[model samples]
Target chain A: MPTQILYKPLTPEQEKRRRQRNIAIALSVAALVAIFYAITLVRLGSNVFLRPD
Target chain B: MSLVSESDLGQQSDFGSAASDASPSDYVALLKPRVMSLSIFTAFAGMLMAPHPVHPMIGAIALLAIAVGAGASGALNMWYDSDIDRLMARTANRPIPAGRMARGEALAFGLVLSAFAVLTLGLAANWLAGGLLAFTIFYYVVVYTMWLKRSTPQNIVIGGAAGALPPMVGYAAAAGSLDLSSLLLFTLIFVWTPPHFWSLALVKAGDYGRAGVPMAPNVWGPDATRLQILLYSLLLAPIGALPWILGYAGPVYGAIACLGGLGMILGGWAVFSRREGDLARKTAMRNFGFSILYLFTLFAVLVVERLTTIWLGA
Candidate 1:
């Protein structure tokens, strides 16, 4: 026999908190991406646009 | 789909755990933002005092990574010490202790941030600074928090090195190496930490005692702790003036360091002599307050002098 899965519903407060955590995580990831992009550009400097044929 | 048992599900929610009630602020609290801010300030001073001018962008990111690393250590500390934290009134309201968040969550958060902060710092700045930041986090989490905090009275003395490294890391981030000047900044904070913390420990011995943490005032008697505070204060005075004596800082810093060092010695003396009832607590509190002002004033003077020279093209 296959194992049964149980589902439980979240209260309104729990849902709201979960939403907040998700949003915060999303924003933090976005900020990290921006930081990486900025560091790459600054480190590459004038060489950023250069490529050898 | 298989049939589900309500008993297996019980009261558990699909959306969250016991930490479900945690808000963003709770997570911020886990980071210990106040301590993080102090690290950032001192690191900025160290960066400014360095000979080489880092690209503004690199400096900003390096500071950010250092701040995040400091926060990660604080989070890890809270995670490991949640039990003792719950026992102490001072730390009772912290997220894990207050039941707003779970210890596992804090541990995961801390570990993830630590990796990110160290790696980003290495890529943004140099590996030397990144290595120092990694050592700081590791020393604080493993040596200070796990090994020493509960086991010894000298916890903060050895652990203070972790706190003192911010300026060294900042200097390395900018200069790509350490100097006597950077080491002096580290030493200033390192020597200052014992007296600074012991004063508060004197005031909060009861809390630390209850938590079973062997703070100086609790492990050694309060009188011994007081004497130790005075001794450290005596050492801190000259060390605080070293930047000026070594010719790295201006006379303004020398004057301020002398005055502030005098104040610190006086505060230490007050705490030392006033060993009775309300007077002792009051003196300890006063010393605690002055120590903060003392370090901040010294660093502020250094930063201002650096900026002045930079601006005047000196």
Candidate 2:
């Protein structure tokens, strides 16, 4: 076998594919954090932006 | 002159070099995402029904920890069972057995996830949650993977404890302690697992027997295991209804629990009615398919009721 670590570093096309996945995971995790924070804001009985006192 | 000679063929799989693309989905497969999803959903339901409130931030983190903990167990399971997994067609395509990821990588991933999950649950939730998470890992890896599976006919029966702990972990995450309701959730899954898995074993008996896996159907014979399935399903009905009987849920949830469990009974009966072979395989497949939905629907009803109570302040 080509050295296990060296059995073809991913071709450029594969690297680009991997890059897209990396971006998706990063975006998803970041969006998850933001969504959870918003849920917390609402779950705690906060609708401040929508309320007019 | 063929490019693929005997010498080249010998070199193909040396030291985990394989042709499969190792993409993000492959790593997600390493997490056993279906199992993680079930664990997360059930645990979240337990948290919702617990006595004390959890901060939503902490709740999300706690759920993530539980999901990670379940994933760690899965990775470890894949590591240990890769041998049998390769032998069985149903599991042959998994990340480890299919050689999509190296055994060493899977092992390290599991260990790291194990540590991170337990420690984070402890900090974000409570020691009880953390402790339960740790024990779940040990139970799945040590008890199910190492001891009971290969050694005993009642492997899944006795080893179902690890699979049943998710709700308890979730309950403790919210309340910082255990309660009868959560333990009831634990017991329900525990009772449900034997019948659930035995149904699968019914259909896969040949594969298991080929792998020398000592499944109940292979060792104890199909008729006995099918009867055992009926007996457990018979037992599961009453206990499955305990939450509503205990008064945590209203009639809507109670009726659904009863009916869903009754569906399992009918499915088990369908298996019980058949003689072993393709006939029994079809029946067992019915039972196996319904069992997953049965548990999910039962829990889903509980969640729906909880959300309704919160919405209407019922």
Candidate 3:
């Protein structure tokens, strides 16, 4: 059997802030992904099509 | 029988309950977004003025990295200076000092972002720019915040170098090497920093004294700080015109630089001469405000000149 987990309940304010933080982290990760994609495209340029199989 | 120790419980409580209240904006506040904006502007100007063209996407990414790097240093600064920050009225409301964020949280945030920023810049641009950004972060966090700020009056004087380096980093990102033009931009900000900061320090001497940070005015007395401000202003005036004299910039930029330099000199003289009461405070405040506009105007002029030259082939 799995050991019982324990956690403290967050205050309403704390819960809201935590939600905001999670959203921010999600947005930042998305932005990072977008940046990486853009940079790869820019760096590859026309050469991306010329890649040998 | 309790499985957790008292110390472990304490740690968990501090990290979990308190941390949950720190919003993303508080994290952004740790980044010192205003300072980051200035760095971004100067870095963008540097990129525009580079001898070679930069791919727009690459340049954007490089700027983003520089901005992130600047923010990282700021977070580290807030982390290290949290104790003193609580003592100063101006800085007392900062995220760390205000109890919105924990110091360890800030430190981890700074270090992680710093690593990400440096690595991203190195990959997105060239390593030279990345290296410069890394050094800048180190200089601001280690040399300026951790060491000089507490040790000597000349902290801002020497520490100014870190703040002055974004443009050079941007130029390197674009051209992959340093140039006289880039160095001149660095020099302009370098010379402009003292009067810009000292004027504010004159007003905030009490705050510095309370915090035990040896700002020039607090340590050297207001008169010496005023004189130093004037001296730096005099130096800054000519340095501002260097780009124009060197012929990289056209007459428009030269005119703005000269007029702006004159404005600085006049502002410096006002601060120097009026050293008595409310008038003194007003002058110093005026100088402090104008000095920001002075640097911004100079860089903005350069950016416009470069853009016009690129578009019109002038």
RMSD of 2: 6.1
TM-score of each: 0.95, 0.84, 0.95
How many residue pairs clash per model? 0, 0, 0
DockQ of predicted candidate 2:
0.11
lDDT of 2 by residue, B1-314 (tens): 44444445433342333332456676678789998999998898899788756887788889999999999999889888889899999899998788666676678778988998898788777889999999999999999999999999999988999889999999999899888989899999999999999999988899999899899999999999989999999999989899999998789879988998898888888888997568778889889989999899888988888877776763
Show the colliding residue pairs in model 1.
none
In model 3, residue pairs whose N, Cα or C atoms come closer than 3 Å (at least 3 residues apart or on different chains), thus clashing, are: none
For chain B alone, what TM-score does every candidate structure achieve against the true structure?
0.95, 0.92, 0.96
Misplaced by over 4 Å in model 2 are A1-53, B1-21
Question: Candidate 1, residue B216: CA error in Å?
Answer: 0.8
> Residue-wise lDDT of candidate 3 within B1-314, one digit each (tens)?
44444444334332334435589889999999999999999999989879877988999999999999999999999999999999999999998788777787888899999999999999999999999999999999999999999999999989999999999999999999999999998999999999999999999999999999999998889999999999999999999999999987889889999999999999999999999999999999999999999999989988988988888873
lDDT of 1 by residue, B1-314 (tens): 65556555543342236326788888899899999998999999899879967899999999999999999999999999999999989999998888777677889899999999999999999999999999999999999999999899999999999999999999999999999999999999999999999999998999999999999988889999999999999999999999999999999999999999999999988999999999899999999999999999999999899888877884
Candidate 3 lDDT over residue span A1-53, tens digit each? 43333544567988889999889989999999999888888998888789677
Off by over 4 Å in 3: A1-6, B3-19
Docking class of 2: incorrect
